[model samples]
Target chain A: MSAKQDNSPNRIDTKRLTLYALLVAAAMVFSYIESLVPLFFIAPGVKIGLANAVSLLLAAKGRYKGAFAVNISRILLSALLFGSAVSLVFSLSGGIVSLIVTVLLHKTKLFGIVGISIAGAVTHNLVQLAAAVLFFGGGVLYYAPVLVVSGIVCGLALGTLDFVIIKKIKTNL
Target chain B: MKWRDFYIIAAALLIAAVFLCLFPGSGGKTVTVKQNNETVYTGSLYTDKEVKLDGNTLVIKDGVCFMKSAECKNKVCVHTGKISKKGESIICLPNRIIAQIE
Candidate 1:
């Protein structure tokens, strides 16, 4: 077995990895901005999920792993920067559920950016609520009605934003 | 812009509607406080008072219950505002305290 493989293939992979890292950083910045917005007054763990824009963009480009990388990093980093262990659990659960939903919906090819974003947003809230129930107690599910409605509105807003951004900028990745 | 997109949105809205309907509705006059899977306090929402727990405080006033203060880093419960309707709750996840209308 050779100690070193060909460097050419690794070069392209490195570029992609670099791009993924940049995307992760950008997503983290968005997450920080989102944290600054006082949306917690509306509901706990509720936001427009702006960092998802990066994930949505990557997923739209059919880069599922890259999208996941950006999303998980954004969640973990934001959880460390602006949240607690409880919030980390919520965000992790929400991020994983939403990422899976977005990826699955994107694979269908029948829906557009807005559709996938909405799917991801809804699932994210649902999974977070499930997490709240598991850790905080069943009574926490009482907040479901308001959370569901807020999720739809926020998801639609984010989806429209994603749609416009995706339409304006063509991705070759 | 596509029909499929509308279909997806409609489906999401329908699911949300179902969730809204399925959630326990308003009209509950009693408020129950649970902490760490234990029923710590149960009382009427009409009563105006406060219940202080480990590093957290619940305040009831004018038939609404809210998190007055908490040692939790996020203070999300405090930001949840007041809950006056049935099926509404204020949860302090770090303290595992949930004040819900019953």
Candidate 2:
């Protein structure tokens, strides 16, 4: 088989749809759980972002579009469910940026799923902070350093979680 | 890096955390307060103080204070002792209050 043919995303099928829906549901649950966890001291907006694991896992399976869809659906539904309009901006930006990063770094053979997850988390924060700048009318960019540091920490935790998860599902993926 | 590298990094982070925890703490400097998506107050903190929010203007009497009178369900910030130290904060989520240092 040629490289191009081997690399293309599989055609839309029930299995793929079901898999994506499951991933989205799982991600949403994780997001909800993250909401309950106590906040760490250093930063306010920082979170574990465990929901990203599902997207990263889907991205790893080469269902990038499905993964992107899952991200969008999760953010939209979560915002609607939570009734937090301010959250919509950050969620959309973070999800889009993380999905983009996941797709871009999909080919890399770094620190397993953990490294990929770390990359996704870092990009997510970057995008969210960018959104904050536009929303707050500027000067909020000064918080980038703290946000970045928090992202790195949060990403590492999520990365570790993803690594364990991917290890268990290596055969299925 | 390999998984072992991650382990080493984790160990290093743990050691650093332990060292910082064991070291003596220093009293903090600047003070910042935010509430309802707005920074209600900003000033220098020399010592512990009482923070009160009256109408539009927030008043910090002791040294430096924050957006006072939190109404959050948890009241974690209000219970976080004082804003006398640097990097301290009083956060009330229900009222969207955050008092910290820069």
Candidate number achieving the greatest TM-score relative to the actual structure: 1
| Pairs of residues clashing in candidate 2 | B28-B86, B77-B91
Residue-by-residue lDDT tens digits, candidate 1, A1-173: 13566575323365687888888898888877876886977766678888888888888788887788778888888888888999898889988888898899889898878777777888888898899667644545556767767777777788788778778887654
Query: Candidate 1 local accuracy as lDDT?
Result: 0.79
Q: What is the alpha-carbon interface RMSD for each candidate? A: 4.7, 8.9
B-chain TM-scores per prediction: 0.71, 0.48
Candidate 1 local Cα displacement, residue B86, angstroms: 10
Q: TM-score for every candidate vs. truth?
A: 0.69, 0.60
Lowest-sum lDDT 10-residue window in model 1 chain A:
A1-10
Docking category of candidate 1: incorrect
TM-score of chain B of 1: 0.71
